[model samples]
Target: MEASAAKAPSTLAKASRERRDIVSGEVMDEARLIRFVVGPEGQVVPDLARKLPGRGLWVAADRVAVETAAKKGLFARAAKAKVQASPGLADQVEMLLRRRLLSALGLARKAGDITSGFEKVSSAIQSGKAAWLIEARDGAADGRRKIMAMARKQQSAPRVFGLFTAEELGLALGGENVIHTAFLAGRAAERWAEDARRLEGFSPLLPEDWREEPIEAKREP
Candidate 1:
């Protein structure tokens, strides 16, 4: 008889694995932390992929924590050597994260795991096929409300994200006015969700004002 195959852990369980923060010295979910490394030039670099070829220096993903690490010379202390972390390190990390998320979205589109436009997205949500709802950060309030309303009617509403601008969404997905999109259930969708969650640490998935409404949905698979 063949031995039983092991099951893969859910994203929630995987994200729960802890990593120690060099700045605060607190152990927290790895997803809530950002990793860094010292370059050959002795400059601190954000290793968002956590695969850079050096010992990692982890910090909480919050802008304040990143700023504190840079301003207080925590990267040098962690690296045990002189390393330059620019004053605008936090801004740089945020830019990189935004780019990474957009690129991942493009890949999802190429993989045919995404449906764009208001009509198709509405269909995806109504049919319970979408696992994520991607709304442009600059999208109109009426459009957002309509999508959220449809999501609320679902037994398992898709997680909503408003992290990219309409132009950015268009450029990434190769369409004009790509204000709303939906990620169908698949590996590509899962990958995009992972990057979106990582970027969420640096920025709110939805605007703070949206919190007053019932917008959130099911957790990641």
Candidate 2:
């Protein structure tokens, strides 16, 4: 049974590699092929978790491949009957990507590679160990402005991100309240950046408008 089951995947992979069109059917490329079973109303869902209970349909992860599948009614054909493809499938994938990035950031914080609060973060910067800067989305603008200036002076100016809210940053850093945080480059930091880049197709950072004002020196409290 194990051999048979293995053969099934090999066969599917091989078949997907070859381009063939059935009568009154559309031709599909191997790269864009995802096989999934239809649920009620013939819903075609890509189970990224690979734990969904049903046959799965295969499709490319990009917008173009999804559109092609819809345009050619390929999903229904694959199901061997009529099936309904979910609306806004591409948006669903993007949401999953964002969740993945958040999880990675949380992991980095747990590994002690991240520090929070104005004082701790400033120390990290002064020590020349911080790789990325994290600011709360709803943090005080004046405070953020002050920090951005200090970051700019560093040899490797840290990229500031404001996507996560203050509450979220606080939770990650194990603090009651946190407005600023810094990540040190290492395994954890690298993983966080990689996930962020994959989800947003770039590093998450504070908007240019937010960084317009230069940070100024202030008396230490």
Candidate 3:
């Protein structure tokens, strides 16, 4: 009779099982990795790959988590010592998040996935191709209202975000200066939307009337 295939040793099987157990927990979960560092006030600021100096602390990306962390000294606990928590740390994080969103929009413009000028943006909306409606925070109320109305007319009703000034928009789009822009869905748009949402969560400005509630808005007759 042909020789039967040799059975693996029981000790070898046990060693293999032990090796598997050791490697299981050794792997880091990407989803659990922290992307932001908390200030002493417990504001979660993006570490931009977590390369910043000093020990880092993390909090969830929400108002409740941030407020709870700040109120309870959770960050100090995480840092294992007392640290100065900056006043308005949340606002600072919001600003940084806005800048990141704008940067993503800039990348989309460079990649030809975005367009500016009122007519072009309007056309994009009409064609249901726009994924985001970007208007300058300092733009005229009438102009913004018109653009927003056009956006609503679109089949998809893309998200409208206004957190940057006209000058900032100009710098991003590489034009004389743009107050209105639209982004089509793609990698850039996805990144921008994520950043914008985070910024909105932490922005000091409450969402009510973007036009009528400006800090410097003048009363009209």
CA shift of 172, model 2, Å = 3.5
Write down the RMSD of candidate 1 (Cα, Å). 4.3
User: What would the per-residue lDDT of candidate 2 be over residues 108-215, giving only the tens digit for each residue?
Assistant: 777788888888888888788887788888888888878777888887676666777777766655676678888887777765654444334222344455645422
lDDT tens digits, residue span 76-176, model 3: 66666665445455555566666777677777887999999899998888988887888787888898888787776665677876767789989877886
Residue pairs with colliding backbones in model 1 are none
Using TM-score, give the best candidate's number.
1
Using lDDT as the measure, the top candidate is 1
Candidate 1 contains a number of clashing pairs equal to 0
- lDDT-wise, the better of 1 and 2 is 1
C-alpha lDDT of all candidate models, in order: 0.83, 0.64, 0.63
Per-residue lDDT of 1-221 in model 1, one digit per residue for the tens? 13222333554466557778988899887667888999999988998888899998999887889999999999999888999999999888889988988888888888788899999999999999998898888888888888888898898888888878899999999998788899898777776666677666667788776643645643443
Give the TM-score of each candidate.
0.84, 0.59, 0.68
Candidate 1 residues lying further than 4 Å off, grouped into runs, are 1-18, 208-214, 217-221
lDDT of 3 at 177: 63
